[model samples]
Target: MDRPSVRRLPRGRHALPPERVARAQRDRLMTAMAEVMSEKGYVKTSVEDVLKRAVISRQSYYQHFTSKLDCFMAAFQRSTALLERQIVEAAAGAGGPVERFDRAVTCFLETLVSDPATARLCVTEVYAAGPEALEHRTAFQQRLGDHVADILEAGTEAGRFTCRLIVAATATMVSGPLLQGDHDALRSLGPRLVAHVRDLKAAGLL
Candidate 1:
């Protein structure tokens, strides 16, 4: 999705606090990085791409990030953190394991579809950034799998593997349709994924 533009400060000094100015600038930079990386992929994106998209100066980019990889990794961290948090909350509160699992699966799919730019980076572009980025992505998926294992009260190795497998698979399912420009098909994935989860559970995989 296209984020609203960052409101620029006046050409000269303004009343905004230095900290607030810095925060807004950083938001612009990260948002821009997500946008650029999604469109161009990690290997193809450049510092200049982000600079132009963010309307922030090259010097400003350096102050916040050592390089494009650094910025993209930071963005990856931010996006995955939020996704995990949302999933946790969705699985929280008054519900049985089944209900909580449903909520989580639904929320996870919805969040990705709702934010295509960030989803593209987290799901696909990370593979292009080499081992570190892939490790971070895999590790987060592992944690998310463990969390789901806790939700399902299935902390066994088989359970963990199944949960993580489905999580990773679901993400791939999304990236395929998204890359193909089939967003309607992508949005329709939740029910199908949940159905597959049910099959997995029935097979004693969860």
Candidate 2:
């Protein structure tokens, strides 16, 4: 997916509701936070940087988030939620389990590559946000792993464990390539990763 635009409203808006206006500004701030964090890393990013890119006022930023980390988590959660939805929707399509699994994995990697800024926030920079981010990451991994288990009809505990392994290994593979800016290599790994899951299942592992 493309990055969300840092769009603006007319100088004197007329018809848009208050809630709509609030959501638009929040989206811009989150988009700016993702992009700025991608470029500068979490430690180096400041509230001013986000406000600058978002073209939003400091007062507006405070209405939604208390700190830069709060903004970062908001963006992280939003981006990952979208990514998860894409995966689930892909897996829900017309196909057998393996095909659905492949579709979901392909969508996952393609999403990461298509929007590197958000990908960086979701994949790499979350680690820099401390314990709250770490807990969220763990929960995300477990939920995603469970999705994979569901795709494979893995009702047993062992099957779920194997799925967890798959998600962890897949994350490792993509993270290195993503951090290196090797987007082609990152996209190419999707098929191989899917194939690994197939191999594991074929061996009666999952």
Candidate 3:
């Protein structure tokens, strides 16, 4: 008997494993969600719109997300995580806590200005995403605040800054406005935002 020849996949084309396919679908859905939400507010963006944009089947969308809200949250969370990483990286090389804080704030403002869609998704749609989404947003904001508090604590220890910091409150005060501001607004507010941190040091507010 002659041995059968296996059919090889064409160049740049092959069946992906289940995990890869799933991951790809999730990413596509999230990307489409972001674009659609940016164009239409979260409340108006339908799952059908996202599916059409992503070119994914309803069954595939359901496999990854339970609802449009779930998909929006997923996109928001991922974008926030990326923003966090960008801030961390930008601040990493600064000379000290104050400088690090300044660098981080600048990067954040620049990012928001440069990527209005992401800023809108994070600061605007997040509020309108309903109760659970608000909860997630609040939690992430608190986490960001904690990070700022750590920087303030380090600065205080070094005698570069003073005051006891209510980390979450301070973080919200700093980030809330910047995140919600438009491109031109954030660009103009950059200096003020930095000054706000400096004032925190001056006032011994940490």
Candidate 4:
């Protein structure tokens, strides 16, 4: 008689464990931190505020993160990752380099528009968090800049767009505006922004 074969589990499907529970709790706290920070600003948002919103104990919170800033950084990083994934996937499916660039621009704007509070936190409160948060923000910008450069370089090489300026500098310009809290204003800026990126000299992009 032969031994029975074990069935394979699907991707991302596995038995729950203590680590998973801990992660879930941490995610809840981060989400709550975003909401509370948006409402009260980072300086005013206490650990108790997050605890109340997350429905977790103070001990549970400390178990996952060292402090409020730590939790905020985790939330910022997670949100940034999600935005990057959406933009990349959208750009990848487009027909050509220019189209990919346009799709990425749209996705980037929409991500901020869909969540004004998160946008506000990133723009205004993140710097106020502390030195560590500022360092994280700089690193985040560097990573995003590299991604933007890859897209622009592809388009430039394909002769679909002109990129005379430094790629990193241009990417930083593209990212700076999306941090605004006013969705209505940002929506209006999208068309002009795209046009400016394409025709950089026309808009004094340098």
Candidate 5:
């Protein structure tokens, strides 16, 4: 009798270990959701679209996220974490308070321009999602403000800056335009934004 012919698994069909498979599925779903949300606003994108894009079934999708909004929230949180890392890295090793603030602003604006989808989702969609979404956004904003306030407090103690306005002003300066969604306006104000940060340093108000 002829030796039994060996069979090969189809391309991209090789079995993955259970943990790897689960991780891969989660990643795929997140990526698909982001793409869908970016192309169509959060309100327009649906769970079915996410499943189709991810090529995962409804059962698999539910296993990962309770709802489409939940998935968007998770994606938004991940984006923010990445953005905060970038801002911190960009500001690291700066010689002065002004330089550090400038680096942070530059990193933030560059991130917005480089990833407009993230900007849109963060700047626009979250608020549009309604009260619960706004509550989540407010929490994030407060955390960021607190972090900036800490930086400002440090600069003041070191005599690198000297003003009580640092906390609220810095928070507003960084987040105001991002919430406005006017790309042209932001671009026009880019130089002014840097100058304002520098002016704060000069006035010891950082």
Candidate 6:
């Protein structure tokens, strides 16, 4: 009798078992990449440095990512995800839209002050990392801006606030002082922020 022919799996339908190991290595590398970037900036960090920090071989690095920029993008996304969660959490459970909006701003500013290095990298490194990084950063900013706008729109619809400005303008107005290094003004203006929300609530704009 003729031997039966062996069957082969279709391409791309199943991943190699090694893919899981590769993913684990990639995650560790991304963590190390963020630490290096946060401490040294992208321009100053080398592939070898990342490899050393991650304790992975050069072959393993390339197996998981195409280039340093790829890893940096992953790290950038991770950092932004954490920031977004914090902002959302800070805004959570507020009495009204305006209060929630103010809390979001406060959370963002506090994040900046607390993690200045990471903040600096997020704000300053995009341009230096070239177009791809810039695009990623821009996307993140736009998403955050959209969220801010949503909050403002909610406030407006609820009669908790009155503003003719667009969402972009409203978001900028809400966050401008904090981003522009006017923390003292923000601190002094804290009561005003709260009052603004209160007034909105009282006016039924919230």
Highest TM-score model number: 2
Locate the minimum summed-lDDT window of 10 residues in model 2.
1-10
- What is residue 164's positional error in candidate 1, in angstroms? 1.5
- Name the lDDT of candidate 6: 0.64
lDDT of 1 at 130: 87
Provide the clashing-pair count of each candidate structure.
0, 0, 0, 0, 1, 7
- List the global CA lDDT of all models: 0.81, 0.89, 0.69, 0.66, 0.64, 0.64
Model 1 lDDT per residue over 67-135, tens place: 888888888888888888889998999887767888888887677777878888888888999898999
> What's the TM for model 2?
0.95
Q: Write the per-residue lDDT of candidate 6 for residues 45-138, one digit (tens) a residue.
A: 8889888887788998898789989888876776788887887777677465666777876776566656544555566555578999888876
Give the alpha carbon lDDT tens digit for every residue of 20-80 in model 5: 7676677677667766776887889999998888788899888889998877787677677
Taking all chains together, each candidate's TM-score versus the true structure is 0.90, 0.95, 0.78, 0.75, 0.75, 0.64
* lDDT of candidate 3 over 1-206, digit per residue (tens): 01111122233667778687687778888878877777887889899998888888899899999999889888888888888778777777647667777777777777766665666777778878899988987777666665665655544443322222333433444355544554665566656765767776676656
Which regions of candidate 2 are displaced past 4 Å?
A: none
Candidate 6: TM-score?
0.64
TM-score of 1: 0.90
Q: Cα lDDT for residue 96, model 6?
A: 58
- Cα-based lDDT at residue 179, candidate 3: 48
lDDT of 3: 0.69
lDDT accuracy of residue 173 in candidate 6: 47
| Candidate with the larger lDDT of 1 and 2 | 2
Q: What is the per-residue lDDT of model 4 for residues 124-181, given as tens digits with 9 covering 90 to 100? A: 5787898888887767665665565566553343232233233334344534454535
Q: Kindly provide the TM-score of model 3 when superposed on the true structure, using C-alpha atoms.
A: 0.78
